[model samples]
Target: MDPLLAKIEYWILDCVENEYSYLWEIRSVIEQRLVDVDKAKLDEYLCMGLSSVLTQGYVQAFAGIDFRGEEQLVPGFSISTSFIEQHKKAWQAGVEVDQDIRFLISDTGFEHYRQGCPPEYFS
Candidate 1:
């Protein structure tokens, strides 16, 4: 994986692990960690990293979370290629996603992280 992508993935996974599932929270973590990287490049890399993980089924995106903190996952919500494309486009275009949308690491993602993010999965 590209170094920037790796860093993005690390921060993403970390945020999910820490219960910071909101997109803005994840972006904040990435921004704080990679302060040297300019905004445009950071947004680009963030879009790429997020799209890759979402398409790979490693991270699941939810439409919202209820008051009880349960995810309100719509059926087939994260399965469409267009969904990922739209997310990337919106992110790069500086359009804020719906505040309720959340990204959580799936079981496979947890396992992958446990295994230390093997290069094959990333590449």
Candidate 2:
């Protein structure tokens, strides 16, 4: 794998796992510093980052995880609602989920973001 791709993957994994409080800002910085890269390649890598990684719904609230990136990272990246499939183990397991998801699963309206937008809004 390309080292730059690996580096992007690492940061993306971190964002997906725990989330970067300043995802868009840091990504902008990264993009600015990586001007030599092709835009298509960057987008491909960004999309790949999500497609290659498997995420748990209840455990991490993959669904409804709101990212406020208003095209700051990608040309048009804004998360209305990122939903993942429900996981039964999430309820039975003793581990605590992300605060955004731990108790919001049953909520009629997600505490953070519950927009009904499609996941491909960015794509």
Candidate 3:
């Protein structure tokens, strides 16, 4: 496997181990296709797809990062140094930017932010 793909696979596996359903969706979509993603395509998917995932509150479970309102900078995490660097490259490549990832939980058949979220997440 190409190194990029190997890293991506490792990261995706980490995502699944963390029980992040949204990220799992990303992996599932690619895996189902059974194809390799070049750097450009990967970057595009991360920027656009990740944004959508974040907007849908999938990032909360997977990212361990907190986002508040639109003004806030969503938090970022690192599963691996190489993976993180690859992610930045994808962003620099101008992947389609859309929704921001935020935190929300579904309960009682409703979607809401997780309770007791710190007023200042960065603190």
Candidate 4:
């Protein structure tokens, strides 16, 4: 693979790790602040966090790639639309699943992100 692609992959892995760590922190906060935090609340937070990653991590990261003349960092010089679509589907599916299960799956997804292919890989 191209060195730039490798860098982008590494960046994505780091971003995903940070995102999961953030989620764990949020879960801890909820557990402490509220005796019983609703599943909906957790899911809502997860959605927001993932949205931030998509917008800030992917989109904003793309800007830096362009500035640095590493357009290949993202395929087609942009965040692949198909990757975004898959992510949207995954997010929707997560929201539709049971809350406890969703949290579990999300945690697993974080690990998968760190070690496995990014959504763009599938795209």
Task: Identify the candidate with maximal lDDT.
Answer: 1
| Winning model by TM-score | 1
> lDDT, candidate 4, residue 95?
51
lDDT of 3: 0.39
Go through the candidates in order and give each one's C-alpha lDDT: 0.66, 0.35, 0.39, 0.38
Ranking by TM-score: 1, 2, 3, 4
Instruction: For candidate 3, write residues 73-102 as lDDT tens digits.
Output: 345522333543554555569664344232
- What is the Å distance of residue 122 in model 1 from its true position? 17
Rank the models by lDDT, top first.
1, 3, 4, 2
Clashing pairs in 2: 63-82, 63-83, 64-82
Model 2: per-residue Cα lDDT over 4-88, one tens digit each:
5545544444343334333233234346646787854554554444333222121122223344432123222222212212222
What is the lDDT, from 0 to 100, of the residue 12 in candidate 3?
Answer: 35
Per-residue C-alpha lDDT of model 4 across residues 21-115, encoded as one tens digit per residue: 22333334433433466854644443444344344333222222123343222222223335344544656576532211111123444554556
Off by over 4 Å in 4: 1-15, 18-35, 58-123
Clashing pairs in 1: none
- Between prediction 2 and prediction 3, which has the larger TM-score? 2
> TM-score of the candidate numbered 4?
0.25
RMSD of each: 5.8, 16.7, 13.9, 15.9
The candidate 3 region of ten consecutive residues with least summed lDDT is: 108-117
Q: Count the backbone clashes (under 3 Å) in each candidate.
A: 0, 3, 1, 0
